[model samples]
Target: MIRGRFTIYLTLLALSVIFMLGFFKQMFVMDVHPYNKDPAPRGKEYSKDGDFDWGTAVKYNPKQKLLLKDTVENILHPIAPEFRIGDALPDTVVRQIHIATSWRSGSTFLGDLLNHNMGTFYSFEPLHFESLSMSTERRLDLMNNIFKCNFHNKEVIGWMKHASKGENNFLFQRNFRSFKICENLLPGKVSCYMDKFQSPICSMSPIRVIKTVRFRVKLAEEFLKNDKDFPHFKMVVLVRDPRGTMHSRSHHSWCSGEECINSTVVCENLEKDAQSAYQLAKKYPGKVYLLRYEDICMNPYEEVKSLFEFLKLPRSKGLDNFIQKHMFGKESKKHPYSTFRKSDNIYMEWRKTVDMGYIEKIQKDCSIPMKTLGYHSFSSPFDRDNFTISVLSKASESIWPKNLS
Candidate 1:
């Protein structure tokens, strides 16, 4: 009987130890090797001869070219001294630009314009890999790693895959030609070694633009303030009129909730962002630029010229051609998210579509941001519908409110 009891106790203890060991291993693996699953093995006789259809649902302009062309030409442009963070950045360090804006703003168009410039490595929304479970610090860390081209980091490798693969293949649309080359080399195999190829290409570029609507200006300000790793940082805070943004967001079903379309919430965020942007601009001079979407739409050529001048990047013929093709080109059935805008006046279409009640609420809820950002609120249907009357006030020209200290 004593031996039986002792044996039972030992068995229970062994089972508990095994359970604990497995739990710890899982936690360790999640922390260290997040993407531990091995890709399926490819056949030894694999060849690119088949009529393997490239996956459908492609969005970018290089239509039907699943195998992206490798036309990346690197241009070494002089960095404007005013845009430097503090001390002179080393020649090896590239200009790091972060476009901080909210969804439905013209950030994609703005980002695409910059990406069209030669020698630019544009990383579109690295935060697409972000989870609600992740803390703010983790998101900032991921941005830092990606901005620095630290693709070799174990965790960042997982994030890069998430941000670039599957439906997110837009990463290869304009920039990342090197990554495209690596991806096509093996067609359907992991042997192309994307992880080994991305960092070198990204780092070799003379400029890296990280365009993200996921990050707020306050968080970006904190990133610039805290992260000492990058010195050649330039932040562009892009904002649009609340009415236009909300109207645009309404087109997408995913863009819902208080954070997405709520007039009060949207303007609150914009107000806060404006305050932060103003302070950042004052603190960091040419390092921070506040760009209004309406301003860009009003006069794209002038705005583009000012933008390029601010960054000290030379105005390239490619960018000029891109703007002409996308901004003024013929309209067609396009992906809802495509940067192709047939006319600049499309931004004003909201005035025709949005109901007066909603406009009233938006004007009421967003009054502070409206006033601060130089947007004119309509008191009546006549004011709202008057094509002769512009919603943009003259104060917007400065990109800063007069009262901002």
Candidate 2:
């Protein structure tokens, strides 16, 4: 009788323990809140009337608990597992991108388009605050480090702290939720943001982009070869017709330097960069993309689709809406710096506005680059004025250096 009672008690105790464990498990599952509960399904276009929530798009894992960190290494390092050796990066890994372009090259619009995607972390001209005193080596290091999401560096931190705040902020036009949150913690927001949010967001984002006109295209070869930290890295060399580029520069007061406005200097850089781009494209294949600003202005939807394809990122509705609203709509007031543009006509505006003599000069100086870039020199004033006569050639018709040889 004693043995039987003891057995019964043991069985009851076992049942109670199991019941308690089940209760706690149910509570844990119910209480666990994901950072983004309603992940707007990938590739599904959001409602035309609704605005896409960028915060939700960040897609921070709900399962991973956030650990507060005081050290740079702890904070900046990505939570994602390292990518193994492969031609294509796994969906889990971030793809680092650089937009190598010159001023007035429609880079702002392009950068914004890329940023509109769900998982992109865009850094706009992080080198805007780059000192003249910085050596080429140091600048390269800074560029590499930015790709690595190491914003804890003093120089990078200084840039964030000193950079312009509003429309002209070099970081990004569309602020991340992390950045917005960190803003509330200021006095030390710059460092605080870099440590707690910016670096981590950048490192974890599936596509990390940095658009800069400061760095030359040739320098990218080093990044492509030397940086093992970012295995899936690519660059887009965004070019525009010199006539359009120069005419656009004329409108802005700050574009006074020889590098900015001089037809000779501008054309020469383009010519050299074209050769470099051609070589890079050949060597790296899919890694180096040459994009013409006019092509996008002409057919934003198709061009952008092609760009997304090149990046191997899925097309999203936010991107579609952005292209539709920005590319087609007419704004009441013109903000020079704003991405808002009458894009369809803006590319051709230089033809009507620029002096014929200046056009002739640009045509002469920029002839080689123009040819390589699929642009044709005007034979006459009528030719320049005639919208029917296409000055742009198909991508295939443009003679690369090897083809020319």
Candidate 3:
């Protein structure tokens, strides 16, 4: 009888323990809060009697808290300021100047000349071989911001160093600009070719000159098509003799395929470029400056001085020194010879190097265009029947050094 009672009591105690444990497990482990549960805290409840109860309160997870903090930080950070008119013109008005041109023109030499002048920042070929997909506004915005921060101003470099963070920090060095040009970061933004121009950034400058070559006609078409804000902008149309241009274009590694051939197509293109330049000069008489490459190379100082005067920039003592250094003798070694060779003798080297057949073909194709630009017609005393062909042939032989035996 005693053993039976003891066993029954022990069984009752074990049952009680299991029941308590299962109840606690259900409350603490099995019950899950629904995703749509009331977000308000469940800490306390107060009735009219002022009775109070305490419970768990809702709080964000640690990971969630961290994410929120990061979001706030990003929102608070100041974005780089974009170029805008009426904005305090950064100490230097010419924050950046893009030397736009077809390859192998004297753009590099011109770039060097601009670089030597104080207060002018040079970005060589920033837009060349770049795509034009970016909306002109966005491109201008980016350019303005970049210039605001990166414009090699003697005063701003120190501030840039302090404000620069992460990748931008490295841009404070002068050499950084050189690296940016080589890497073609600006061009890379547009997939390596300039298809359009809509940027206010380019317009913001008191002066912006686009150095261009054979596509001068196409560029004129673009300007006509697009609505631009610059009423007083200027274009300096630089031309070299077609024969000389062809000679330089042929040997230049950058010129390839059709451009390499001194065929009728090439002559036609040159004629179109020259005519286009003339047409632009006619259209915007005061705004267009026609500069012959041969004339400029022969009398660089005079030409550059006149150019600066035309642009309304102060012709300083430093600019005079730059012209002297780059214009004459071995001091000009700093200039890239492959692109800017100033041999008065080699100006018309195409006559010697290009074949007679090609010369005749070019003359025939270019006669109309040449005449349009005021060149003597081949039909004149130059030649009776095939005047165009004969004149070009004679001129090619007489003028082009590369053609000389």
Candidate 4:
């Protein structure tokens, strides 16, 4: 008993010293810019066939992409030049990319694929912060804080408040790996690894890829312009056919037997998700990369290669080997997309498995988005439509937001 007490006392003493050191560095060395608490306007929500002129969605100037290289170089304040274990990063340059989608939509699979690349410091949905019970704008703001590395922000603080309280297991799970990967950059090895598992790719990586299925498409677009808050960013929206999506969700008994053998909310959300993704690609020409789940499943190599090029990441042989191994390996089922079967068969499984009536309804509700995403009707399942080559995109520009302007 005395030994245990002595151990506890020493631990406390060590932590106290570390805390003081952090405080000393904060006051005398590192440049401390006050965190921005100014709330940004809530982004426009997704709504299809509405009276709004924005029509499904519109594009940013490709020239605007250059702004990513700009950063706040001159902080005209009294501060010392110093380098710490984890230095403050510049808020410019294309350093972070996000794969945003909805639940059960192959996000986890895509995240796994990105993690296969050594160049990418991949985090599996750090912003999948399930406890932030605030407004959507507030949630986006908190998410911005996370990407900005503002660990002390109220929203971030609350999410990880229990982290130090013997909750290493909780942190490693529940989409907190992204936060912990960043923690690897922080000082002190004992506190981070004393009770937790560290990500293998925690070494100094230039690119950071975080995947989240929480935010809608419109909200993601709003951040395209808010660089001061979000910094250098690129986003990809992963979309799967509504039938396939419903089929995947209905695998569990609780999620089936409502609208189209899945709940009404499920069906409705699928349509909304498609529209949201469609709208973003339509409006933000070079801003958002909309990837179809079918395309990835059909040709994971080509599709992922295209995305890597878009994100300007070099082709990684490690990623190629990972995909090759998973494509044929009998890896026990973990992700929705990972299996012994080829991804080609996974894309069109819904057509053969789901009811014909359900397919028609999903197609009807999501026709534009379906067509926009290269998904065809029951009448033409083999057509394999492509959105980027469609005239619909050109037509969409005419309906751009005009009334207020």
Candidate 5:
């Protein structure tokens, strides 16, 4: 009888493995192509469609293409510094600041805050050149040096100067035109880019803040690693709760006809990113600041004050008021484009919303780094071993029971 039972158990286990493999293979590999009966004219693959396809292309908005193109042009055709034939070069000292963050992590708000002060101008996502074009590393190196005042390469500087003139205005025009073409393309009515960078306020700032929100951390790492000679550069990393972040990201993914929660890649990537940011912060103590979204939302004034101090900027008028007005509060409604907006309301909501089973899986997979981020304990009943278990137990009694009923 014992022998017969063992054989049955082994057979069942083999079948179970096969079933799981097949299920996951189908879940991940199945492709769903959009059905556009009258296909719109294709520009460069992944380029902006001049003719709009209302149904299919709403989420794949290409407003940033103009900005990117202009940036490239600026690098290629920089204008010569205007100095009379034999005059000495003007001693203009320029400082560069890089604001790096994972997408949708309030880097925009931080950038706006900095732009409000002296010696700060906002450059949106200059690091995306790596994925957008070939020879990204070379371009990034040239641009980095040009901004740093160590740009001895006259050819590169001339190219950039020529590029900056009409390029900035051209980008603004393109983005505005694109927005008019499809009003629903971007969720926010006021393009913060338009509001912050285009106005008279932007012209007053002297220092430049390059705001980038690439999902990958390696992009910034590569730039920093390569440009060791660059001086007086500061990097600010903005982070948010992964649960809220992923929730918002998921909605955006769905609108774009992509799967968000289907893959565990984002969670995995964020864990790696957080660790990278933490390490960078540790390595460059004074130069790097890790700003958390939750902390910012909770006490906007305090956080903004700290940030201004870190950036060596003065406490400007209406700074606190601006933060208070925009800070995520109880009265705010969930943004149609981002579900994470809803999740933002619940502090530590991951414990409440995530399924106990999935939470256990994530905890098991990411325990080491999660603990490193102060999310775990060494002793007591709710230590690392029982952290998820305890959360699950509490959730089971208070959170999930009503839903099940």
Candidate 6:
């Protein structure tokens, strides 16, 4: 009787232990490894008579492969795992983009567009604080370090480091405009000494974008060479039709302060800018985006959508609404620095604003670049405006396509 009773008790205890273990297993999920190494898909390259088009981006995606793999994994194990936000950041890659543009190429509009993206640490004309004073090699070296996020160049890096509460009395002007750094610092927020300079940079959104008209796209080849750099760098070269670009430059007093009356000046600058943009796009397939200002103004919705897709940022209503307010509809909210011109007419405003005599000179000097860029060689300014009209009729076609050979 005693042996039988003892056996029954042992069986009950074993069963109870098994039941408790099963209950605890169901209640909690333990993920020993929190990071995912699966990389997202990238836009592919295609030859479109030397223009970057939507077809490649539309069809090829590196993410699609990851998506399929994940689907299969899920199907194999029919249980869904609970996700913890804190540890999930390693799943995404942080992107660092540089907008390499020339003077008066609608870069301000582009800058504002990228600035609106969530978790973007955007700086305008970061090199404006220097460049003119430094040698070409020195300036390039300084830029190299800044893009690398290692403050090695004391002269320029000094400008990026010192911040103040009021109009910064620092030598670098606005680099550290709102913050007084702590004498000693820690890794996280506890180490931060000020709030005004405290930016909303977190793990999930780790993109640092600096828009500069200073650095040419050609100078950025070094950063793109590295596949394993800590802060991965990408570049987008923004170009504008020289007629408009030069006219805008003249209006803004940008072309060497002399009378920039010659179209050769426009031609020479456009040649350099176009070559840099074209070479970068060709060399770095997914790393370089050749964005045209006229294109942006033409179909802002699709243009910006491609840009955002390249940046790996999700679409925001704020950006969409901004485009609607600025680029779409009958009237746009005028920018302080920008002239009041309709988006459609603005790209061709050079026809009206520029001197007629300069047309022949521009055509002579700039015909190759103009044709290469798909800008029709105008026998006269009338053809240019008419060409602009035809192009605007189908805003889907971009003149400075990234694939332009």
Q: Clash number for every model?
A: 0, 0, 13, 4, 10, 11
What TM-score fits each model? 0.74, 0.73, 0.48, 0.60, 0.50, 0.62
Query: Which lDDT tens digits does candidate 1 get at residues 1-405?
Result: 533332333333233223222222222111122234653332222235421112221122233222222211111112221221112223334578899898888888898888877657788776767644467887787778767777777656766666555666655554644444444344432322344345645655557888877777877765566446666678888989899999989999887677887888888889999888987878766677888888887778888887787776767667777877788888522677788886568778899989999999998998888888888888899998998888887555565643331
Q: Write the per-residue lDDT of candidate 2 for residues 112-181, one digit (tens) a residue.
A: 8887775566777877766445667877877777777777776666566545344344364454433444
lDDT of 5 by residue, 1-405 (tens): 533332333233233223222222222111221122443334221236432232232223244334333533453224322311112122232335677676556665666666555334455444333432426556566456434433234433333233234333322222232223222222222222222112222222235566655534545554444334434456666765444455455546432321234325545665676677656655545556666666665556776776666655556566655555455434444554221233234435445455555555555555554454433322332343342432212211231121211
User: What C-alpha lDDT does candidate 4 achieve relative to the native structure?
Assistant: 0.50
Residues 1-405 of candidate 3 have per-residue lDDT tens digits of 533332333333233223222222222111222122342232122234432211110021234334433533453222222321112233333322333334455655675665554333333332231224334544444333344433343223222333233334222222222233222323222201111111112222233333323233435433432224333344555545554455566665756656445456666666666666556555545454555555556567777776665554555567766655555545434233433253443344454455655455555766665554333333332242332242122232122112111
- State the C-alpha lDDT per candidate: 0.65, 0.65, 0.40, 0.50, 0.43, 0.52
Off by over 4 Å in 3: 1-102, 131-215, 218-228, 259-262, 331-343, 349-360, 369-405
- What are the RMSD figures for all models against the true structure? 17.8, 15.7, 26.1, 17.4, 22.5, 18.7
On the 0 to 100 scale, the lDDT of residue 6 in model 5 is: 28
Over 229-306, each residue of candidate 4 has an lDDT whose tens digit, in order, gives: 556577877777666777687776644335335445554655676676556656655556767676666677877777
Judged by lDDT against the true structure, how good is candidate 3?
0.40
Residues 1-405, model 6: lDDT tens digits: 533332333333233223222222222122221112332221233243432232342234345335434643553224323321112123124567788777777887787677665444455565655545656687666555544444334643444443221233322221221112321232221212222112212222345566776665677777777666634567877877766766777655345732244566556766777787667667767677777787777777888888876665666569887776666556654553542336766677677666657766666788777766666556665665465344232232455453442
- Model 2 CA lDDT for position 266: 90
Q: Which model is ahead, 5 or 6, in terms of lDDT?
A: 6
CA lDDT for candidate 1: 0.65
What ranges in model 2 sit over 4 Å off?
1-92, 131-133, 164-178, 185-193, 395-405
Q: Rank the models by TM-score, top first.
A: 1, 2, 6, 4, 5, 3
What's the CA error at residue 374 for candidate 1, in Å?
0.5
Model 1 lDDT-worst window of ten: 68-77
Q: What is the Cα-based lDDT of residue 176 in candidate 6?
A: 29
Worst-scoring 10-residue span by lDDT in model 6: 27-36
Worst 10 residues of 3 by lDDT: 191-200
Q: Which regions of candidate 5 are displaced past 4 Å?
A: 1-93, 127-139, 142-204, 215-230, 254-264, 328-360, 376-405
